[model samples]
Target: MIRSINVSSATLRHGIIHSPFRLVTKPSNGLRFCRVRPLSRPSRPSIILARLYSDEKSPKENIKPTELAKKVLQEAAKRENIYTIPNMLTFGRLLASPVIGYLVVTHQTSWALAVFGLSCVTDLLDGYIARKYNMQTVVGSVIDPMADKTLMMTLATCLAVSGDIPLYIATLILGRDFLLFLSALYYRYISLPPPKTFTRYWDFSLPSAEVRPTTISKYNTFLQMIYLGSSLVFPVLSQSITIETAQSIGMALKGLEYVVATTTILSGLSYVFSKDAVKILSKPNGKP
Candidate 1:
């Protein structure tokens, strides 16, 4: 019956300490009694219980290395690189491109105008923020152009579908872009290590393969945007405007379309003919 009693600290101090809730035969008393005594060092069950309670409150101690790495990466992603202000604007523009295309195809001119206008503003803002904050990243360099091209092509397709612009113009622009994309991919992955055809024709040094937008390409993009925005805006007014006025705007749009098409072709040709492009594709000893 005394075995049910709790162990006292005084009994433990007197060297009677043993595992709690265990029966023991005291040599001095020659009688069975439960020795309820706290161990000087923690018992196995106490150690396990302590770990269980501690793990409940501070679970990081139990996290595996892989999970820790994943968590750290997730936390770090929020603070750097893609999450920056300029990059966020770029991503937002990418998301808005589909909406712009949808609005255009659905003939929601007013809503498309608003969204397209906001995208244009963000386009400017993103560049400015990147420059002012020095927040540029290699990924941004790649995706910024990608976002621009996607938006441009999307709007162009919508315009062509709506009969606002010639389908051939969109075809030409997209064809050039597709060719440039292929060339860039080839230069990046296959040009290095100097292929036999490349080494036989030209002599040049190869650096990192980053396909930057040429000056002509920049102008081409600007003109394309101007053309697209005008195309979107003028049609909204076609409902309230006179035929002569609408025709005048239509003529301007046609002129812009021609200009854009010409620039698109020239920019693509410029890349193909540029010394840098040649150097990137050629070897150091070959001459052309």
Candidate 2:
């Protein structure tokens, strides 16, 4: 191997990185000082720029650009836009859940029906507004379904206590929600980065997992809402109708009860079997 301290003007004009040279602290080309200002990313002619600064260790080796990009994409979790019209509506429904349940339990049939109707309206409007106005958010995704579940559970429990809906159906609904809640807790803990404190676990801003409701689950929610809603309406209508018509409505409701029960079971199983139901956002090792 030949080593030369050639630093000629002509050699520089052509290219200064051709021949073998010893690993000196500085080039012998009289250009002893090198000021490597950080560059965003250089355009084409990548080889020339890299060779000119070969003295500076290759950023590729120390800082893998591919790995950096992948990390960015992985950590690119959506910021929680907790304040939004849709989320506000969802919150409203959540508040109304207890109100509606209390009204039902207290035998305020008319008021309960009114509040439940309002809750359903918000439920429909929130989703539509989120989609049309591009207000879809990560928190919205979470709270929307959460509000629905809360409302459904409250209503189911209330109606069962009032003997409007079957105990078996209520039991099924509560069981499914209980299992899902436990699953959610497990996923959240596993996905949360290290140093997980009580505060961090509850922080929606640092979302650790995503819950994707399955198709059957969605339909089940809709059916359950209808069943619960009809239960509220039944008391008011049964007052205005004849005994024969009341009996017929009761039979219809019984059949609906069977349908809702089947859907609830299927929906619960769907979450268990489906691959995309609940996704863990980060690893236990704190890598996103």
Best by lDDT: 2
lDDT of 2: 0.78
* Residue pairs in collision within model 1: 202-286, 203-286
TM-score for each of the candidates: 0.62, 0.72
Q: Candidate 1's residue-wise lDDT over 132-199, tens digit each?
A: 98997644665677788889989988998999888899898788878876775566454434344554
lDDT of every model, 2 decimals: 0.69, 0.78
Candidate 1 residues lying further than 4 Å off, grouped into runs, are 1-80, 188-208, 276-288
Expressed as tens digits, the lDDT of each residue in 115-165 for candidate 2 is: 999999999999999999999876677778889999999999999999888
User: How many clashes show up in model 2?
Assistant: 0
- Per-residue lDDT, model 1, residue 12, is 31
